[model samples]
Target: MLNEEQAIEARATLEELHVEHRDLDLVIDHLLLSPPPDELLVRRLKKRKLLLKDRINQLESALEPDVKA
Candidate 1:
């Protein structure tokens, strides 16, 4: 049960992460377009992107209201 301030902070963090994820997407696309892209660097970036996705999901779930059956 997060307070209003905590919820606001969490939302802000989520927005920041979303922006970073989008930025990473652009970078990955650019990397793919160029010939002889660094395989290792791309792999690392992809891994980081996945981690950000997981964190985003977590925060989203946390922000959702709990449901009771």
Candidate 2:
């Protein structure tokens, strides 16, 4: 089980990651709508989106305390 401080930090980190995810979504939308989309920029945005998803999973896991079977 996480202590109070650890739990608080984890929650804060999760919030920050969620905000980042939203920002990435906006960027992706903009790129998709561009008349002459930059393939390289699109690729980079996709990669970052994947990374943020993984980070979100990790954060959620951290927020969950161990449960005995």
Candidate 3:
């Protein structure tokens, strides 16, 4: 369980990560459009995007309030 302050901070971090992920997506697409795409760079960016997605999922789960069984 997160305190109110911690929750707020986590939400802010989540937002930042989402923005970065979206930006990376755009950059990757643009890079692929250029002739002779850089395979290595694209791979690296994809990996980073995956990591951000994982983190976003984890944070979202954390933010879910517990339900009584």
Candidate 4:
């Protein structure tokens, strides 16, 4: 379990990651629509975005409570 300071830090990190992910989405969309898109760069960006999503989910789960039946 995270302490108060650690939780705050985690939340901040999560927010930063979210912003980065959103920015990546825009860049990827632009790259796809532009003439002669860079397929390799887009693929790499997509992979990085997925990795960020996973990390965000992990942090969110840790910061929240779990419900039991």
**Cα distance off (Å), candidate 1, residue 54:** 0.6
Cα lDDT of model 4 by residue, 1-69, tens digit: 788999999999999999999999999999999989999999999999999999999999999867688
TM-score of 1: 0.96
Candidate 4 wrong stretches, greater than 4 Å: none
lDDT of 3 by residue, 1-69 (tens): 988998999999999999999999999999999989999999999999999999999999889998899
Clash number for each model: 0, 0, 0, 0
After superposition, which runs of candidate 2 have C-alpha atoms over 4 Å from their true positions? Answer: none
The true-versus-predicted C-alpha distance at residue 42 of model 3, in Å, is 0.1
Q: After superposition, how far is residue 8 of candidate 3 from its true place, in Å?
A: 0.2
Give the TM-score (vs. native) of candidate 2: 0.88
Comparing candidate 1 with candidate 4, which one achieves the higher TM-score? 1
lDDT of 2: 0.87
What is the per-residue lDDT of model 1 for residues 1-69, given as tens digits with 9 covering 90 to 100? 788998999999999999999999999889988998988889999999999999999999989999899
lDDT of 4 at 5: 98
Native-to-model Cα distance after best TM-score fit, residue 24 in candidate 1, in Å: 0.4
- TM-score per candidate: 0.96, 0.88, 0.95, 0.94
Determine the backbone clash count of candidate 1: 0
